[model samples]
Target chain A: MVEAWQWVTKHPDKLAGWTLEHIWIVSVAIAIAVVLGVALGIYISRPGKEHIADSVLYLAEIMMTVPSLALFGLLMLILGTIGLKVIGFLPAVIALVIYGQLPILRNTYIAIREVDPAMIEAGKGMGMSERQLLFKVKLPLAVPIIMAGLRNAIVLLIGITAIAAIIGAGGLGVPIFRGLRNARMDLIIIGGVSVSILALVVDGLMGRVERWVTPRGLKRR
Target chain B: MIRLDQVTKIYPDGTEAVNEVSLEVGEGELCVLLGPSGCGKTTTMKVINRIIPITKGKIYIDGTDTTKIDEDELRRNIGYAIQEIGLFPHMTVGQNIQVVPALKGWPKDKRSERAEELLELVGMNSAEFMNKYPSELSGGQRQRVGVARALGADPPILLMDEPFGAIDPITRVRLQDEFLKIEQEIKKTIIFVTHDIYEAIKMGDKIALMNEGRLVQYDTPSNLLFKPKNEFVEQFVGADRALKGLQLIRVKELMTGTPPLAKADERVVTVQARMEREGVDCLAVVDNEGKFLGWVDRVNVGKGETVRDIINRSVATATANAVLSEALSLMLSSGFKTLAIVDGINKLEGVLSFDAIQLALSEVAQRRGSE
Candidate 1:
């Protein structure tokens, strides 16, 4: 414990760099996931597309079942064949984004689908065009639930991002792997602790964002 | 003014919701489309605003064909409300009420001012309710906000499909009365849809009674009650048509102007002699200015020196403007054979009697029989 504390204090800059890298990878991957997932969600949730939505949701569920490391390996292989970087940031982001799809996609689809039909009817009756109804009524009402999914994707990506170090993606995982290779307990402890703290801080920030974006009328007193 | 010329709506599934229904609602008229569920009353109303598109025929709004206008533009000019209220839960009451105005690109201050004006018009205090969400409001309050929202842009035409249907019975009646009062001031040409017979009678200047997707009869509430076009119309109006007709007649219409009355300073014996001459058991005692003081009955006339000495201040009285149905209920509940019809300040106007109400009903029956 004493050794771990001293090492962390002495190498604060190194710790900060790894934490920033971890945050960057997770943020970028989750951002892409949100766009793709929400767009797909809206597309699939349109009327007469229930079968397509069901099949897409099923595919997302199947993708979620793939182990993170195995999915990363699969992406590495696929990207290598496509003449892209076989290891590091590209594959790591790709893997995290794939993993992030289920929560964000499912939530967006369900949130949009679950909006009250009567509200949509009322909007139409009041002369709101289809586009106006989507932006003004449906999307605003779906924000809280979609944010829940976003938070889930973000937290999941942050944790999984540490594993990217194996492919030389360079996050807090680098220290833990190096510590294991050299039998350094203090290094491993610092890396593990930093990743945990990073996940918690990011999750807390996302929680605040979720609450902020939620419509005031939707909030429970 | 709105006119439907043989408007027909047959859904894609081959269900004819509104079949060749022709009706005209004049400017500022509150026309009720009343019928049983699945009778296409709601469908007929929705057709006016093109919410449910008509498959055949045409609707004309103030001499312009509805199809000639852009649907959104047409709908924007026609205020719409439904039974569910459908108030956007995420919006504040003010925001909800300002939706159409905001859509029309009104300046923010103007839109908000309109919302405040409408909220007050619906009996909601803007200060207390402007920022509150629909979820925070009670059902009746939400309903009022729904109505306020419908009147947002001050549309000359309004389509209300059971706007008060979801409220409790007492609140529903209150809301209806308040809405009618609002209608009087705004004078918008409104097409109100409801299944409740009493609501149709109370709210509609003219009722378009539909059945099985066809116009069964279109007439005033009194005509619908007394001169039903056919057996179906009579049955639909129900067996208690005469009693329902009472709802249409105001107390002042049947009330006798020459009511048995005694001055507060008049001798009790003299008032008793007058009551006997008028063939009434009681006389409405009034002050010198004709402001109603109380009542003096034959039984108490002999025990007092003056009418004021035995005046029964608890005697039930109705306003001259009150419907006979209200007067009847007040008389029945208060165990009075006659009600002194007074003005707002309790000045004696006339007397509404049980016998007069009976005579009114028999006269209506005789008129129906002669017809």
Candidate 2:
């Protein structure tokens, strides 16, 4: 423990830089996943499109069942075969984003479903067009649930991001990978502890953001 | 004013929800569409607002074919309230009430003022309730908010689908009373749907009873009770149609002239003599201006005391405009044979007695028998 703490203290600047990089990559991946998932969820959830929604949800569930490491390796090989660069951040991010899509898409579908059917009737009865009902009533009510999905994605991606360093993504995962190659117990412990601390901080902040964005009437007192 | 000429609605699953039904509701009239579950009353109402498009036939609002006007615009001009209320749980009472006005792009200050005015109109304390969410309110309060929201834009037409059906019986009665008062003031052309016959009789100027996706009868509550066109309507209105008919007669119709009154300052002996001279056990005590103070029962009078001191202040009373049914309930509940009918300022206008109510109903029965 003393040796690990010493190592962390000795390379504070490098650790900080890598932690920032890790946060950036995960944030981007999650952001993209959210946009794509929410759009697709809304599309499939429309009337006459329920079967499509079910099919998409089933596919997302199957994607979630695939092991993340194997998915990443498959993506790396596909990118290499396609003659595209596969050694660094792009493949890592693509893997994280693909892995992040299932929760966001599934949660968005469930959240939109959670909106009261009576509310939709009320909206239309009160003269709201389809667009207005979706934007003003359905989306606003679904947001808190969607944010919860985002929170899950954030935590999951934060953990998965550490693994991204194996492909030269240069995150906090670098130390753990280097320590594994050299059998340096101190570096390994420092990486593991910092990643945990990083996850905790991100999770806490995401929770606050979720609460802030939620409608006050829907909030837990 | 709203008119429906042979409207029909058929669900996509080959179910006929509303058959060809033609109806007309005059301006400022409270028209009730009443029926049992799956009787197509709700479908008929939804067709008015274009929430459910009619499968056949035409509907006109103020002589404009509904399909000619923009559906959204047409709907915005018509107020709507439903059984479940559909209050946005995430909004405060004030925000919920301001929905239509806000949708119409009324200035914020005006919308806020309108919300407060509507809250007061619905008998909720605006300052106290404006900031509270729907979940914070009881079912009755939320229903009130639903009504206030519907009236926010002050539209000339209102469409209500069992709006009070979810409230408890007691609250439903109170809300019915409050809505009647509001209706007298606003005079909107209202189409209210309900499964309860009593509610339809109490609130509607004309009741349209439906069954099997078709309107069976459309007429005034009294006409529907006294002049049923068929056995279906007679059975639908039930066995106590006469009692329901009596509820439509206001106290103002059957009430007799006010009884002799004693001034509040009159000596108890003098009041007692007045009651005895009038051959009555009690005399109403009024102020010098003839405003009703209360009533004095002979048993409570003391020779040395004044009428004010001997009066029963807790006696049940009714307004002259109150329906005979209201007086009947009040008298029955309080064990009073007569109800003092007061005017707006509590001045004694007349009295409603059990004899007068009996006489009214018996006369109607006699007229029917002769016919």
Candidate 3:
């Protein structure tokens, strides 16, 4: 561990680059997941669309059950077939976005669906159109819960991004893979610790964001 | 005025919530839709604003067919409140009250001014409560905000479904009285729904009593009490309806206009002689200006030199505008069969007696029987 610390200090620029790469890839994937997941959640959670919601949630659950490495391999094959880059950042991001779907999608769907029914009734009775009801009432109340899902997805994707190192996507995962190849326990500990720290910090920030976005009326007195 | 010409609502599952109910509510009149649970009073109200689409029949608001108006446009023009209050938790009290006006594109300053005015109209302190959330308010306060929100755009018609139903009984009565006062000032045509017969009696100018999705009786509260249309109407109004009818008639309506009066400076013997001549046990004592002083009973008349010295100053008194039930309760509680009615400045108006209440009840019963 001491030697790994020394090596990290000796190669500060390399460490910084890898950490930034890890953040860049995970951020991109989560950004895409948030937009796509929220839109799909809203579309499927509409009244009379329960069957569609169920089917979409089922598919997301199946995607969640697949091992990250195996999913990446499958993505590689699909990308190769389509003549796109099958390794590095492309497969890494594609795989992370897939893994991020379950939490983001499910949370968005549940949050919107579970908004107080009385609020919707009041909005409609007050002459709010469907679009206004969604944008003003339902979505605002759903923010905290949806943010919880986003936080969960971010943490889960950060940890999963480690496996992207196996396919040559440079990130915090690089040191752990190298440590494993060279049978270096300290290097593996360093990589594992950095990933854990990154997840914790991001989650803490998201917690602040969740509280900030929540309406004052919803906060505990 | 609003008219429902055989309005019917049959849910897709074949439940007949409202079955061809026809009624008319005059402009600025408060009409109460009253019934037990599952009796379709709420369904009847919702159909007017098209919240629940009618399966058949037509509804006209101010002589315009409701179907001819767009649903959102129609709802915007009709104020709606419900039992749950249904205030948006995400919005402040001010924002909630500004909902309808904001939707109609009122300018910001106008919307806010309207909100403050409405909050005051509902007896809430606008400056203190405008920025507060619904959760921060008591149930009664929330109901007040709900009403202010309903009256947001000041639409000519208001629909309220048991707006005070969720409050504690004591607060409920106070809210009912306050709302009635507000109603008098605004005079918006209103369709109020309630299962409480007393609320219907207190708040409605006309009551449309329903049973099993059919209109059993649509009449004044007095008629519902004294002249029920059928057995169901009789039972729904309850067994003690004659007593309840006391709530409908004012003290002045039943009090004798020319009650015998004894002057405060008159000699006791002279007052006693007057009471004896009138064949009455008591005479209301008044000063030279006709301001009520008290009463001088025959027993007390001879006990003092003048009516002033013999006057029972602590006798219970009621305002002329007070309902008979209030007067009767005061009389009963004070152990007096006769009650003095006075105006705002203690001026003698009339007198109420137990005999007069009995006569009123018997007259109603006889009239109903003859019909």
**Candidate with the greatest DockQ versus the true structure:** 2
Clashing pairs in 3: none
Off by over 4 Å in 2: A81-84, B255-296, B302-322, B340-351
lDDT of 1 by residue, B232-326 (tens): 89899999877787777777788888476788888888887888788978888788788987778888866879877898888777766566777
Among all windows of ten consecutive residues in candidate 1 chain A, which has the lowest summed lDDT? A154-163
Tens-digit per-residue lDDT, B273-322, candidate 3: 88889999998888888898888888775577888788888877876656
Q: Which runs of model 3 end up more than 4 angstroms from their true locations? A: B250-371
- Per-residue lDDT of B239 in model 3: 91
User: Which of candidates 1 and 3 is the stronger one according to TM-score?
Assistant: 3
Worst 10 residues of 3 chain A by lDDT: A116-125
Task: For residues B1-371, write the lDDT of model 2, one tens digit per residue.
Answer: 69899998988999998999999999999999998899999999989988888999999999999999998898899999986558987789998888888889999999999999999999999999999998899999999999998898999999998889777876776678778878989999999999988888888899999999999999998888888889989998888766776777778878889788888888888878888888998887788777887778887876448877777777777776567777788889878687898864578898888999988788767655664
C-alpha local distance difference test of each model: 0.87, 0.86, 0.88
TM-score of chain B of each: 0.78, 0.87, 0.74
Real A-B contacts recovered, model 2: 0.67
What is the lDDT ranking, best to worst? Answer: 3, 1, 2
In model 1 chain B, where is the ten-residue run with the lowest total lDDT? B169-178
True contacts kept of each: 0.69, 0.67, 0.69
